[model samples]
Target: MTAPVAFPVVTISDDLALATACARWRTCPAIALDTEFERVRTFWPKLALIQLCDGEYVALIDPLTISNWTPFAELLRDPNVVKVMHAAGEDLEAFLGGCGEVPAPLFDTQTALALIGKGVSLGYGAAVQLYFGITLAKDMARTDWLMRPLSDDQLRYAVADVTYLLPIWQDCAQALQQRQLADWHREDSEFAARRLQQQEPAEFLYRKLKAAFVLRGQQLAVARELCAWRETEARNHNIPRGHLLKDESLLLVAQKMPRNWPALSVLETLHPRALRVHGQAILNAVERGLNCPQAQWPAPVRRLLDVPNGKAAQDAMVAAVAAFASTRGIPAELVFSRRVLENLLLAIVDGQPYPPPMWQGWRRAAVQSALASELTSFGIALPDWW
Candidate 1:
């Protein structure tokens, strides 16, 4: 903590160097990993550089030039070599899309720190300052990583991200072990990595649209159809989905289900470009949705969040779980995030026939059998098959 750590930055611009570094990484116990990617203009991120470190050495692999990612993918899949990163969701996305791999035995320093009760949601630079009293530069926040021949300053900034990761993870892991919460971090990392690695279908992307769940059967159908169409159109054109059609505008069209451009153009939410180029296609999708059979309508989007009972049942369940967690000294957020708890209530409200994560693995471990007993006391039973 007394000294600023320094290491030589090895730039790997070709296949040979990348292969060599991958081979070396496979032998290391753990490595620090980070990436720089361009995501401003496209639906999919364009990976620029991948930075890795193993305490003593740092390597910046140029993803722009390297053609064969097999070696790197193998290294990432290796179970023995832990990949340490901070807030790794987006990086995981880029890796799955670019390299066909998701780093296993992953130790996310951000998750680790939060699990150990060190910080709630700390960024890489703030974490470094808190743990080692070293302030990292922020000048490279929006740099054009896709540019060739990165400046010396950019390379330096990139390498600094991974250089301290190993030491920081070590400290956090030790803290977790001291508190007998090491298994908690492992559970979270594996669970998060699994979810990140899976590619959810774009058709379901409409579920994320604001207020999409509030629509009734036919209206929801139109929104889903429009959302799926926008997803496909955006990807085929390699442009941002909003550039093709905004979510607000899609919702407006879904509600109105206009049969012609003039009718569609009447909505204030419709963009000029969207109406000019894609208006007819949007109308076609809406017509199909309008004729959709009642059985074919999608489930009410997250309707449980607005359950009419003042959600007294849901409120009592979350409060019971919170009190139970307090007795076991588990961090309330880690046991089941606020969102997870809400989703669980939403599922129950919708009569979903399965148990949510809160009723399984880590949540059960933290609360013993109280969660189940609390629900049983309400005469509510989880399906046995679940």
Candidate 2:
């Protein structure tokens, strides 16, 4: 058996040390990277720790100690070197949001592992344990990486994360190549690279409350107006959107169209302060809902799918996809999961072109074929289903 490699923990304390570490990383062909951040109470994540390993050496950059970030940021933007991270979504967000750039030529080990049927969305600790039989210590997860005079144990744990990652990636990459699934890894990496721009408006700000769809056009108009008001209030206050008004409360207010402060005050879901401060505006919204013309109301909610047999056709397609996933030793959720499969089924029944399956390789093929047949049965032919 190959002896385990010991990782040297280098804390970047000066500009020279930081630059030297980046220079080493820039020359290396690929490096494993990870970050620690706190985001519980803030709009943006507070980056506390950054860990990088270039096969031979592991360097832990303490953000609290070093202020000059230009050297590290330049290395991050370098496209020649591949950056590897396990489950890199939030880390990528922090990097882009902080330094205004994301690393190019990025490889996500978790995605690569899933492509070869290792496990869907596997945790970093689990992946390392499975491949190396080395159980990683978890005590440093909630440690204050932002504090100075870091303990020896915390430094060792941080270094170990990326040090062992190099070997784990090599093993996983080899397995993927043997299975002819290397292209899947490439495509997934590309997909994750694009995730830096796919931010969506929060659902609470846009989606109508559950069962709010049952209301008439005028009621929906009221709901939309109230939602717009609440969204603006939440932003101006710099509080969570729900802190201003819950979706259910907004729906009820729109439905009832209360004519007076007393009537609105009776709403159980309304926050006491919201009623005290904006009760007049709430009444105005209710009045607008009551008087808005039918033609001016928001459009009706469209059904997701319109197949000939609807639910029956959806059931058949789902079963087919699930069976195909099982036969390949991959989890059915990794293929389409129940939620995405249901949406896809609805789109096919509605005569809409199927959306790209999130999974790669044979699983995507299985989902596409099943969806295509369902669409054809509804007299909708999709030539690009392949």
Give per-model TM-scores.
Answer: 0.87, 0.75
lDDT of 2 by residue, 187-215 (tens): 67777767565543432233346555566
Task: Kindly provide the TM-score of model 1 when superposed on the true structure, using C-alpha atoms.
Answer: 0.87
User: Which runs of model 2 end up more than 4 angstroms from their true locations?
Assistant: 1-4, 13-17, 65-68, 143-153, 201-205, 208-311, 323-330, 346-366, 378-386
Error of 1 at 95 (Å): 1.4
**In order, what lDDT does every prediction score?**
0.79, 0.71
What does the lDDT come to for candidate 1? 0.79
lDDT of 1 at 132: 80
The root-mean-square deviation over C-alpha atoms between each candidate and the true structure, in angstroms, is 3.0, 4.8
Query: Which residue pairs does candidate 2 place in steric collision?
Result: 306-349, 306-350, 307-349
Candidate 1: tens digits of C-alpha lDDT, residues 25-105? 899999999999988888767788899998777988888889999999999999999999999988887887678788888
